[model samples]
Target: MKRYLQYGFTTFADHYGSSEILYGQFRKGLLASAMPTTPRPIGATKWCVFRSPPTPYSRKYVEEAVRERMSRTLSDGIDILQFHWQDYDDPRYMDVIQHLLDIKRDGKLRIDELGLVNFDSRRVDEICRTFGSGALVTNQVQFSLVDTRPLYGMASVCAKHQIKLVTYGTLCGGFLADKWLNKPQPDPYFDSLTPSQRKYLDVILGAWGGWELFQTLLSVLRAIGDRHNGLSISNVAVRWVLDHQFVAAVIVGARLGVAEHKDDNAHVFGLRLSQQDRVDVASVLADRTDKI
Candidate 1:
């Protein structure tokens, strides 16, 4: 399970201090060296193992791609190669899965497990069911306090298939923290926002009961953090998600070379949410939020 790895840029120095598990949208050779291999991912980017099945849908394409990435990545093998199907309309994803599994069975590709990225509940059900359970073990998705859609459906689907969710955006692009607490709502049109801040800002304004209510949620989180030996708003937010049984891990965002949160985030490791903490967080959600 990968969690607390918030590095936007990766460096040996930054990587050394970051979470043991490495992840993200790859930048070619950045992750090719100096790492303890766990279940590292490859699907989000096109260069992953299976460099992407090219046109013609041939197994050789997949085989060669897998070998190419494996050669570039860990010499022994990739612990788990995660796959992302960009176009469900294209049935070739099945061919990719088949090729990867077939290569693994042949003991050449050396992928121990196959996970997924951003697949919906229905498709996850279908993939596991069609591929005969255990085909995929984890599905990465945008899940957090602001976006709880997974709880209604993804949670049950994962339970049925015995799959766990690898969650990103758990901190709502760093919005659910003490820094944003009681701050005036920034003008979306005029203000500068990072890609993540912009995305979650929309969620906060349109769906999560707007800026005013979001402030309320942040205040509650701050209070909860104070209760927990003065933990930061971030620690409380991350803990809330970790408290859920279905989530295998929550990925927090970070700026590798520019900034590091290893010390700050370390607090979340053993943090446990009390019943009252849950209730306080829930109260904010109950009173002010769309069904999302």
Candidate 2:
């Protein structure tokens, strides 16, 4: 499932690389032609496909990407293919499902080889019923120590249906790490980063109770890190999400050639956040509202 979904990103990247996809064309035009065009989302910006500067990814591109990925997976001796959609109603979605079923009947694709992503908890049963039992594999969503709303309903639904979860934004873009512990409030326009990056960082600070409160939260995590054999704050953040049941994996972003942090990221599985560490984190995070 992850492989198919991850491949989708590269598919979009390839399209963008060639300026064939709608958003890719739009972005290329915006950059090269210097025309004042309306911004479109290239893909899922939040958790799935984050397009810098934002652009619309049309249905045609998604369908093409899925087809190519599915074909590649079948050729690789992998029977399962996890299909993901930001919305449930795209015509290509039905077409893809029907195509897969047709192929499965003809011994091309297997029935147990399909899955979905981004559906709400309320729709899980419907998904399972429509797709068949064990067909819908995952409901990837934004779940983290800072955001517990998924636990209220989605987690239970997943548990009931025996579906797995692939969580993103667990570290909230490295904001949970010690880098922001006592750092001053970020200048919205001072940094050269993307608008989306600045926006999420601000939200993380605000939700963690601003800079002062964030310092306190960092101290607690640091203490926990010491007890866990000197695990870093990032290790604790990732572990906190992974420690929860139903989380099959936590998607952590990797900046290529940044060898300094790779060793630290690897330590997440080595140390566990103690019960007291969780309590302290909750205490700091209590009553703080989300900024997303």
Candidate 3:
């Protein structure tokens, strides 16, 4: 999906040469004329798309904002649009979504589906109930062993409304990998961790019971991986998220040429946690008191 959307081809001049289905597109003009040499392949998937427009209280501005995005997305042959709103207390999200529904109803836009990102359970339920189940397709959120807050309330709402979860942060910003397994915790003031690393590290130390407990969790994951033909801890971490029935997909961040995990990632499909593996992981998790 990244290759086709970003470069307009399935394979680019990169070290990792593998082919996968293009299921979704996140940005507009990713296939625009800037890279005209690579036209979209014939019969490429009309992506389930995502965009974030500034929140506006007026229904008129909301419609205008979405329409502008729709024009760009349609130009790229996309049919679905997902939204991200930060302040739910604004109460204008419903109006914006309602405008989107009206545009779809009026046949003014080509959006075949609408979805949400970072929306809580209550709002998701209200939207589905207000617009009907068919109105929204999925809700994107952070879900992983380290961040299981969704399981408490969001998962139940999704299961009840049949809204699929598109999860991100499953790898805890790359901290759930072999590189950090037995390493000492970094000094936040001096370490050169990326913004993503620093953010998830806080989750690990603050929400996930600090470095000692995190090390214990990593040990259990490593042991589990050893039984599965020396799979990496990252693979096991991702598979744990996929093991959930409510998860439609796990979003792993990629740095096109800088780094690639395509080879190790394929192993996730083949590695399934045994009943004993689940038990061991659960044992470690049971000690955590943080909801996130």
Which candidate's TM-score is highest?
Answer: 1
Better-scoring candidate (TM-score), 1 or 3? 1
The candidates, ranked best first by TM-score, are 1, 3, 2
TM match of model 2 to true structure: 0.68
* lDDT against the true structure, each candidate: 0.72, 0.58, 0.72
Q: Which ranges in model 1 have alpha carbons more than 4 Å from their true place?
A: 1-54, 71-74
Give one digit per residue, the lDDT tens place, for model 3 in 21-68: 112122333444356655443221111224435554565765665655
| Lowest summed lDDT window (length 10), candidate 2 | 9-18
The 10-residue segment with the lowest total lDDT in model 3: 13-22
lDDT of 1: 0.72
Taking all chains together, the TM-score of candidate 1 against the true structure is: 0.81
lDDT per residue, candidate 2, 1-292, as tens digits? 1122223322122122222334333444444654344332222111123232133445454445445543432222223344555555443445455555555456543333444456677666666566665655666677776666677787787777788776767777667777777777677778655454575666656664466666677788888888888788888988888887888777675443452365677677567666788888778767465522
For each candidate, give its TM-score against the true structure. 0.81, 0.68, 0.79
